[model samples]
Target: MINSIKTPNRLVNEKSPYLLQHAYNPVDWWPWCEEAFAEARQENKPIFLSIGYSTCHWCHVMGRESFEDQGVAGILNRSFVSVKVDREERPDVDAVYMAICQALTGQGGWPLTLLLDTKKRPFYAATYLPKNSRYGMTGLTELLLKVSELWKTSRNRLLESGEQIVEAMREQDRTGYVQEPEKNLLYEAFSAFAHSYDSRFGGFGEAPKFPAAHNLLFLLRYAKEENPAASEMVLHTLDGMYRGGLFDHIGGGFSRYSSDEKWLVPHFEKTLYDNALLVMAYLDAYTQTKEPLYRHIVRKTLDYASRELTAPEGGFYCGQDADSDGEEGKYYLFIRQEILDILGENRGRRFCEWFGITEQGNFEGKNILNLVENANYREINPTMEHCCEKLLCYRARRTFLHKDDKCLTSWNALMITAYVKAYLILEENQYLDTAQKAERFLEEKLSRDDKLFVRWREGVSAGYGKLEDYAFVVWAELMLYQAIFDIRYLKKAVRFADTMCDRFFDDTEGGFYLYARDDERLILRPKETYDGAMPSGNSIAAYVLGKLFKITGEEKWRERSQKQLRYLAGSSGRYPAGHGFAMQAFMDALNPSQELIALSPEQEDLRKLRKLVAAKPNLTVVVKSPENGQELAELSPYTKEYPVTAGHPQFYLCSGNSCAASVDTLQALKW
Candidate 1:
């Protein structure tokens, strides 16, 4: 049956791991193109737009449950023009539809399903419906029948709702936007978080805890600037997660999200974004406390990335599937007897005790460790080192981990920043080298025609770079510059930033648009700024501009950054908690930041620069080429006075209005 349906899809020729994933689906699905929409109109059939990415756990679930069923596929093909969209490659379409779905259903998530009129107006929307009616939600068949009935009998009703939804989105987009001034917005966000703080468990609110690593980072920034309680909220959550089953104690990375509030039991899905963001949060936590365990998490997460997710060429994969053998959590969840079988009697008992695995079990007679429950027992008998070794050995046996081998540029950029920052703080060269290798992997596979593509699976690069790709990579470039004084990198970054300004920048509006005008058409061209689960492109654009201004001594960059703040000023108060990550970018906008330009070749300057950078709280440093190093010399000119013994190190410290004295020698570099 699947073989019959594979005949008409353009996905037959595509290389994306996600596209290939649906290649065998019995539904005659069409990839997003004018062709599918044209066919829908010609056939006078409604369109079924199924938007999802390769890594979404529920996406996989819906695919297996609905898409793979021959009977459901037949229904999908006959009743509607089924169109599949990889949200990662086409986020613009995803955003518009996701917004409409949330508007119609009052909730939205992946495996997004929308039944549209032949005219391409959404009439009905739902996410993750079962093939047959089982759960409280309606069945896919009944949904198709109902929508078809409406399309034939009450077309005006569909059109009216569609028009209303779009108009509502436009009005909201225009209103509730205001400019951020200081930590008030951030403090307000923290104040909101303070209300939701789980004093016992650490993360905000109750059950289904997402790592919200960026939120925690925002908390730390808040802690540093506005309130101690804010930072405490982050650290306590980190402690809870680390101690919880949310963290795979043996494996280095985090699962998708916890099933319950305590972070003890997870949905058992490991994702690239979760791990990447968690790595960033843990690294930041280590920066604050220098606690050995947090440092261990930093290395462990990286190690996990290196071992499972890393492509042979060096870039990381998109994510790992939560389901295997048609059973969710089967690959990750373990029975008590199996643990003893692999690890033997003595080692197994200790492992079971450490992981809190018992015969009665935590989940269906299986154990998922809410690990640090018996902290006293662990502390007195075994050191953390002993526990780590045993757990690590036990975790190594899970060989069925499903890694989504599609390398994504935006996600990789985040990883690069995390790795670069970790190496900077930890003084580990391996992490730095791995960061460089990942960057090189992106260039080799994802960049062509000076335009970066989004996904790299097999050998093909798919889609033009999204705003996230440009913004995060620009941020990563600056971080790379800070870690190693690469002049070429600065030049390259300037060129990319300039390209971004030309292609995606909104000259009329202050903020950067989500995609270039040439990008695939969607209903709306929204300029996103507030951070959600992921960082917003507009916020990141503002972030880059602020950092670039400090680096190049350009006033225009500063002006642009300020304008973005103005655009995002409204509605920021309403969802300040969700906007925590972007608030860090907002903090950059308000601060008179200095780009601590280091003047030297890449080698010696890197060594000298690390000392200048290490252990400095709240200092944002940018390394510049030795040649233009003097251009910023007016900022911190004291570096030129004292010649160093080994290799010359010149530092230029420029803030908002004035330049501090530059220092060259280690002695002169004293703060």
Candidate 2:
């Protein structure tokens, strides 16, 4: 009987560590599958869906309290068809439930619990309920009983509510913003951030400081526009954050957020999405400024993901849990005694003092792995290349924390973009190779026809891919193409972009929907434009659509891109955060400013041509090799084609997409 039960709801372990975590759960949970829904219908019971990613602290808490509790298990097994879902794996399922939970609770978080009718329509949802009910809310047992009772007594009401929500979830607005965002709006947003900026702290808001990298990205662009200090403010905050506790000095990654505003304390969970986006931001900063510290963080963060979060199958994992053994931040937190023991009193004291690891400790008598406690690695600036190699090794010696190994396409795509960008900036060929390998793994492994699956843990693919999967993957493919000029990546991206335009793009409303038409239903399809901890799909779509137009020169793509940007432009003033998409979109909207520089076989010619362009401010230059480099060369009217007459040096100047006539020397193009 036990073997038979396991076979019906069994998850085929593929690559995710998170799904495997539930492989042995007694509740007879199945990954998102038709059989499970069939079972629910056959049993004539509501579906008990638990959605969470691996690194979620609340997810871990809820699992220990409820899933691990045999009493709770008994109740779940007897009344409902229980299912375990990693939100990262099956974002469609999570997205639907999250919408319901947020609408009902006014907020939503991990460890999402929901009751859906046999048709997979969610009638009720909540996040992280305690087992025994101590925090003013009802206990899990009581809530379960009440929901079950409601299902039994008022099935009609549940159907009505679920149907209405499903309809609402399908609706999308197709009208673009009335006009493009004016300069005043950008100025006003920057001014607001400055006024609210925390002088002592790195972030803009109070406690639970999210790394607001999106806002800072806007700030950097704004600063480059006119206000020099505006850019400085962003850099200053980033510097503080890098030095603060939010960055895991020893582990080579960042925590979810700083518990305090000053960036001295963190919530301690390292999310793959957060790290990936942060690395992108940091890499951008490093590219423009050549800041060593920013580059260090980027490398370290990438190293951490590659070492710890990567699956053997070449895909990236979701995250690492924030807590361990019921104590918050236990696996990561360190005592002063341990530090002293690890590196002796002198270096340990210095490390503690440098990273703010005092005798009293920063969090519950244990020091979070922050930079403040370390010796001033920045100021000292010894031969240590960001202290990542040694620290990551040392941190490994301790209890390796539990990792969430679910591979979400969106998150993997983001990481892919980061790796591609880092490869471009650092000229590290390995990063690019790794990026392509991971992309291949997703394409060959997780994709089913045109529809993409969100999470793959332990070799099992579960959950429907949402709009995020398309947006982020398109963005990643674009970067990958740019990193190596691959046509295949571009072609794949083009096909997916079309689907996004046809299916996910809101024709009546200018914004995009979070889920595809064929995906599961939730409270609302949720046209999310706000840039919260991460940039929203609507915003991402706008940016990606704009890029596709630039790459492919398709006017239809450009129009769609404009529509997406315009959609957000209407609210850009009120929601500056929404402008994350607008920022990248703005670049494409500009008059195509093109500059091409060609190099002869001579080194001096290359340097002179590079300096000529680099010396100019606000201009982006694209370089080409002399061998088979005619794509840009023949197109460039400014730069001479193949062999230079001088045979020593050559140069090209171009305007718009077209280049000026080729010049034999840099001096030929000079005034």
For candidate 1, the TM-score is 0.91
Candidate 1 stretches greater than 4 Å from native: 1-10, 176-180, 376-399, 595-605, 611-618, 622-652, 662-664, 667-670
Worst 10 residues of 1 by lDDT: 376-385
Q: Write the per-residue lDDT of candidate 1 for residues 1-671, one digit (tens) a residue.
A: 14563454567666666777888877898888898999988998889999987767788878888888888888777878998888877877888888889878898889999987766678678899987788587988778777778878987888898777777887876664445556677768878889999998888888878888888888886676657767778888888888887777666688878888888877777777778888888877787787777887788788888988899888988777776666666666677787678677887777778778889988876777557666743232344446556656766565565667888888998898888888888889999999999988877898775677888887777888988888878877877877775645566566678778878887766667778878875667777766767778777777787777766656677677777676655546667777766677777666444445455534655676665554543355654444655534443343344333324556666666666786764456534
Give lDDT tens digits, candidate 2, residues 1-671: 01335433364453445556666566677777788889999998888888876677777677778876778888888888988876666565666677667766788877888888888888778888899888697788887788788878988898888777666555523332446755665666777788777777566767877886877776776665547667777876787778777787776788888877778777788888889888877876775688788888888789889888898889997777776666667766778887777677787676666666767877888876556434454553542333334555666775667776667888899899889877867767789888998999889777877667777766678666788888888888777765554456766787778877777877765778778777765445667676656777777888788666644555788688777777777756565644664654554455344444455436555444334332332333434455535554433333333454334445556666666777765677743
Report, for every candidate in turn, its global Cα lDDT versus the true structure: 0.75, 0.70
On a 0 to 1 TM-score scale, where does candidate 2 land against the true structure?
0.83
- Native-to-model Cα distance after best TM-score fit, residue 547 in candidate 2, in Å: 2.6
Each model's number of backbone clashes? Answer: 18, 38
Among all windows of ten consecutive residues in candidate 2, which has the lowest summed lDDT? Answer: 612-621
Whole-model lDDT, model 1: 0.75
Number of clashing residue pairs, candidate 1: 18
